[model samples]
Target: MSKEQIKLRSMIITALFAAIIGVMAQLTIPLPLVPITGQTLAIGLAATILGARYGTLSVLLYIAIGSIGVPVFAEFSAGLSVLVGPTGGFLIGFIPATFIIGLFLEKLGFTFKNAIIANIIGMLITLAFGTVWLKIATDLSWVSALASGFTPFLVVGTIKAILASWIGIIVRKRLLSAKLLISNDIKQSA
Candidate 1:
């Protein structure tokens, strides 16, 4: 395919991943402070499959849409208020988390092992951002924030990380084979 074709395809795929993130955000196990959602899983998938540039782009797109009052966040929440709410840090953190995950895989190659490592790191990044933000946003003590926003997610986040890595690599390979994805690396820029 020509450069324009490839770019168009990549844009479409990136937008699709953004939609996927929104859909996944709806999968929530609600908590008092912050719910457990599949948003992180979709973030991992985007990073592993689309790499940094487009992965980050997908995250930005998701946030932009949600900020515009679309019900795309966890529990179908949205708008600028949601972004600035207690959970906002986690939402904002998805940007760096997705970028780092994709950048790690892009540099290290899209192996399952690498994806796992990257996803784990990304998960931690999200949790850290969320925890800190939760503490400040809610005026909770650090201990409370950890309990509410961080501790509860460790095991679940690990599981989701593994799932994202495994499934992402599988789907990424298939996409590449089908020429929907550019290559094994998927390092194309938007």
Candidate 2:
């Protein structure tokens, strides 16, 4: 395939994966305070497989789609209102969270250990943003924000982070192998 064709294919695949992440956000595990969603998993997967630029773009695309009343968010919520709501910080945090995660992925490369570290750092960034936003939106202090958002998900977040990180590494390796095969076939045909 030509270079342009390859680029186009990559963009399409990235968009598809972004859509998948959006869909995955709707599948939530209900909890007492805030429901846990599979969003971080999608974020990690997108960053790992698509690289930093494309991964961040895919997340931006997801937010854009959701903003336009797509019912893509948790519990089928949508629009700018949701963006500015109490949970809006977490929703908006997706942007920097994905970017930070992808940045770590780019700098650290694809290793299981590095992947785990990347997820931890990435989740920390998200928690920071979410906590700050929660505080402002709900008129609570930092301690309260952390109590509600970060503390509840500590154990489960660690597990999901590990799972997502490993999955991302495996997916990235598979994608690399497939790309090499495609490149070799193109060369042979040429």
Candidate 3:
């Protein structure tokens, strides 16, 4: 592909992942403190497939759309308030987590083991940011913040990370074979 074609393809793929993230966000299991959502799975998939730059851009676009009143968050909720709310940190954390995961996949090569490690690290990043934000947002104690924000989601998050890694690697391999994603597309941009 020509340079322009490559750029256009990258843009399209990034937008596609952004939409996927938005759609996944709607699959929420509401809880008293924090809701469980498929957002993290989508994040992992995007990062693994799109690499750091495009994946991070996709996540940022998702957040921007939601911040602008698009009903793309959990339970179809949106707007700036949703971001500043108790769960906002988790949403914000997706950006860095996606970037890190993508970076790992890009640098280490896309393998199941690498994907698992990357996803786990990404999950931890999200949890740490979310826990602190939850404490501040809810004025809860540190232990309370961990319990409400971190504990409840541990098992589910681990499962999601593992599943996302497997799914992402499979999808990425298929995309590569089909030429929908070039090998260079998965490389980290300087």
Candidate 4:
């Protein structure tokens, strides 16, 4: 493919993942503090498939769209308020989390084991950021922040990470085999 074609393909893929994240954000289990959502799963999948730069771009795109008052967040929330809300840290954390996950996958090779480890680490990063922000945003104690934002999501996050690892690996291999995505694209973007 030409350089322009490759760039266009990458852009399309990034946008697609952004939309996927937005849709996944709606699959929420509302909680008093932070809602549990399928966003983490989508983040893992995007990182695993798109690699670091593009995967992070996808998340940034999602945040940008949501910040523009689009109903793309959990419970159809949007705009600057959502970004500055208590749970916003988790949403912002998605960028770094996805980048780290994609970096590990790219460096270590796109295997099931790597994906799981990367996703686990990414989840921890997200939790840490979210917990701290929850404390700051809500004026709660650190312990309370962790209790409400971190502890509640541990089990679900682990399950989602594992599932995302398996699904992402399978999807990546299939796409690679079908010539829809080039291996170099992943390696180069790392």
Best by lDDT: 1
Those runs of model 2 whose alpha carbons end farther than 4 Å from true positions after fitting are 180-190
lDDT value, candidate 2, whole model: 0.75
- In the range 1-190, model 2's lDDT, one tens digit per residue, is 7888878876787688779788889879886546788887788777666666777888888888889998888888889888887778777787787777777766656677777887777777777777788788888877887898788877877887898788877877776777731222111110
On the 0 to 100 scale, the lDDT of residue 8 in model 3 is 91
Once superposed on the true structure, which residue ranges of model 4 sit more than 4 Å away at CA?
185-190
lDDT of 4 by residue, 1-190 (tens): 8889878888998999999999999999989989999999999999988888889999999999999999999988999899899999999899899999998988888988888999999999999889988899999998899999999999999999999889998888887887677667434321
Number of clashing pairs, model 4?
0
Which residue pairs collide, candidate 2?
A: none
Off by over 4 Å in 3: 185-190
Better of 2 and 4 by lDDT: 4
For each candidate, what is the lDDT? 0.91, 0.75, 0.90, 0.90
TM-scores for all predictions: 0.96, 0.89, 0.96, 0.96
- State the lDDT at 167 in candidate 2: 85
Expressed as tens digits, the lDDT of each residue in 72-169 for candidate 3 is 99899999998899999999999999999999988888888888999999999999999999999999999999999999988999998999889988
Model 2 vs. true fold: TM: 0.89
- The residue-level lDDT of candidate 2 at 105 comes to 66
Distance from true position, residue 1, model 2, in Å? 2.9
Across 1-190, the per-residue lDDT of candidate 1 in tens digits comes to 9999999998999999999999999999988889999999999999988888999999999999999999999999999999889999999999999999998988878888888999999999999998998899999999999999999999999999999999998898888878887854534322
Candidate 1 stretches with Cα past 4 Å from truth are 184-190
